[model samples]
Target: MRSKESDQTKEGSPSIVDSRFTQTLRNVQGLLKGRSFPGKVLITRLSGQLDESSIPPPAYLRSFSDSDVGPIELDNTFEDGFQSRSNSNASSSSSKMRTLSNTEAMSDQVQKSTMGARAIDSARLMKFTKELSTTTVILERLRELAWSGVPHQIRPKVWRLLLGYAPPNSDRRDGILRRKRQEYLDCAAQYYDISDMDRTDEEISMLHQIAVDCPRTVPDVAFFQQAEVQKSLERILYTWAIRHPASGYVQGINDLATPFLVVFLSEYLEGNVDGWSVADLPPSTISDVEADCYWCLSKLLDGMQDHYTFAQPGIQRLVFKLKELVRRIDERVSTHMEEQGLEFLQFAFRWFNCLLIREIPFHLVTRLWDTYIAEGDALPDFLVYISASFLLTWSDELLKLDFPEMVMFLQHLPTQSWSHIELEMVLSRAYMWHTMFNNSPSHLVN
Candidate 1:
């Protein structure tokens, strides 16, 4: 089989005029190829025109109720206490995102520009450490605190505790880390040795894909741009893939590994790890981070392993659910999308697969993960609701566009300026939506 990366190399760089068209086509191709449907004709229908009479009644129309779910009440003391921006106009609406409180006394635009690296709150940091030390692990309390946002400095240790990677017993912590880190290094010594001549064809192919994807994983991050950093990523991804042959080496898994890598790497750094150069770090420090990341990422993926399995059942179910959820939540947007012949998979596949890693900034992504791990095994189910709410966050803007424009808008949202505060708002709204509608059956009537 021809490799995906090799196909790109042979085509060379696409011209500016056809780039968007070429890119969108490639995206569609990848979606269809990655998934397994009955036939080629059935799959090709994804991009074809939708005839009104042929469209099935939306899944939610027959199932869910139109009754009002009560308004969401947010806590006032939550980090960067945010007020949801409201706009009556359509075109300017997506701009109406979560912003700092009025008492902050600055415009949202101004706040965005001036916001730098988030500072760790000493009280919260102390509180988290104390809670972690307690004999009885109060998970509900931890989830509440984590939902607000983990302090940046303590996030690495906090994540380990939250994910069950660290023991509840403090006495056993050092021994566990020592054993796990060495286990990873030993695996690397055996399987990841590039010098080995006996590497199988599948192993070679997996490594090639990892190498091609490593630099592209988090292109904007200065930390990920270094050759050494990319090699660390390569080892983690390749090692994980080789071990888990069932879901081996999916494209989006590469994106999923970065948050763990960065967060774990921060544990060893003196100051903000964002500005610290990877080349300046010792090889052992890098190896320790790689080991920790491998284990934590394994924990994360374990819940949603079906997502990257044969045909990605988890994503398929999610896109279907997202369509149904949107139909019930926002009829206009759903109707508009149906009229445009849009399948939820086109925009939503990456959303489910990567846990919105590609959509949000890295710092914010870690904060999001803090809540995800805290939420326990239900992350996959809850993410469908989050993805639905995230899509509708731009409903006003999406309602204004045509087919191609809507696709482009949904793919690259106006999230360039989104910070931890904005992320908190999105997650908060999603939690409300999930609570209200998740259990309401499609057969129920208002």
Candidate 2:
């Protein structure tokens, strides 16, 4: 793999040829933008994603008397890979924010035909489930349903249901405030075992205090930053636990809450008007939500199946499957790996299980959530497509390296965040590449 030497090569010379090639690539990419399904999918995905947040209620939004909806500022740190893509979708609601430049703002709207906001009925769910991971098809649907230039009246309700955030009520502030007030609790003790091993009465008692029982106080941990964010997550998990007691309080539940928290509460957190800190987040709800988020993460991990990924072989098998797919698809890349003498697991392990968790931006994480939600079940195809796209796009630089450099190359990607447009372009290129190579008997879908 080659390190980016164009910088070094252009140092002394005027390099008209290099300049021409760069312009040519850009023009080609521009042309491919609309026609390319993967590009369109990635573009919409980036545009639609959001980070977890705990936004405070606005002055106008507050109810006549009580309001637990504090002013929230967006947590930029957790806003990492999931929500940074800046497209038209980053606008405020049409009813609010006087900033409505046009009809198209938020892509998600209500579907009157569907009973709930999820817009997905059993029939639709069945259709979606069957179509799981055809990356091209998934990307196509993403682009088709994109909120690119939508009006609030036309946006679908299914999105809100999928993301797990209740949409703004007619009386937005009061509804949120009322929900917040009810969520706080104080008698709970910490339940460190989110992995949900069998515990004795003392432990169950502690979990009951915070998690299962009433009067819970969840801590203000780094991930579930806001009280409201934590509370909503708690509701999701407690409800889940009631539904599935055997799988209660698993470790990775927090990860599941992340997408919803960021989306629902992000607006409040981004504010600095009240100048209140989350450090002042109420003790009861904060700690409770964290426990719930952690436990929900456990539920998600339970969904993943196998022993927890703490020290075990669960993730390893997924990594191995990814490696298998990669090896089958591009033996040249595999050959490059062997020639460079890189241990495939060392750098790529994080890529598979975490699904680029620490790698992309917050907004992109939202976009990923959109696709992940839409995929319903076929995760591997989505995973392999993105992994392959990342590697292939970076191939020019990656091909110039040895094992150490390759490792360094993959690790350094998160440093330079990709915009929705760029990510879409990469996927488009990969889609085209796959179209060309797929007939040759090497593809993940096969």
Report backbone clashes per prediction: 3, 70
Tens digits of per-residue lDDT, candidate 2, 327-382, equal 55445576688788887678766666556655665445545554454343344445
In model 1, the runs with Cα more than 4 Å from the true position are 1-120, 194-196, 270-274, 443-446
Per-residue alpha-carbon lDDT of candidate 1 for residues 90-207, written as tens digits (9 for 90 to 100) = 3244433334343353454344433321122444566677787787567666665675567666778777777778776777888999999999999988889756467988889889
Q: Which candidate is the best by lDDT?
A: 1
| Residue 239 shift from truth in candidate 2, angstroms | 10
TM-score of each: 0.72, 0.47
- Best TM-score goes to which candidate? 1
**lDDT measured at residue 42 in model 1 versus the true structure, 0 to 100:** 14
Residue 352 Cα positional deviation in candidate 1, in Å, after optimal superposition = 1.0
The weakest ten consecutive residues by lDDT in model 1 span: 60-69
Q: Candidate 2 — which residues are off by over 4 angstroms? A: 1-160, 163-256, 267-303, 306-314, 426-446
Alpha-carbon error at 18 in model 1, in Å?
46
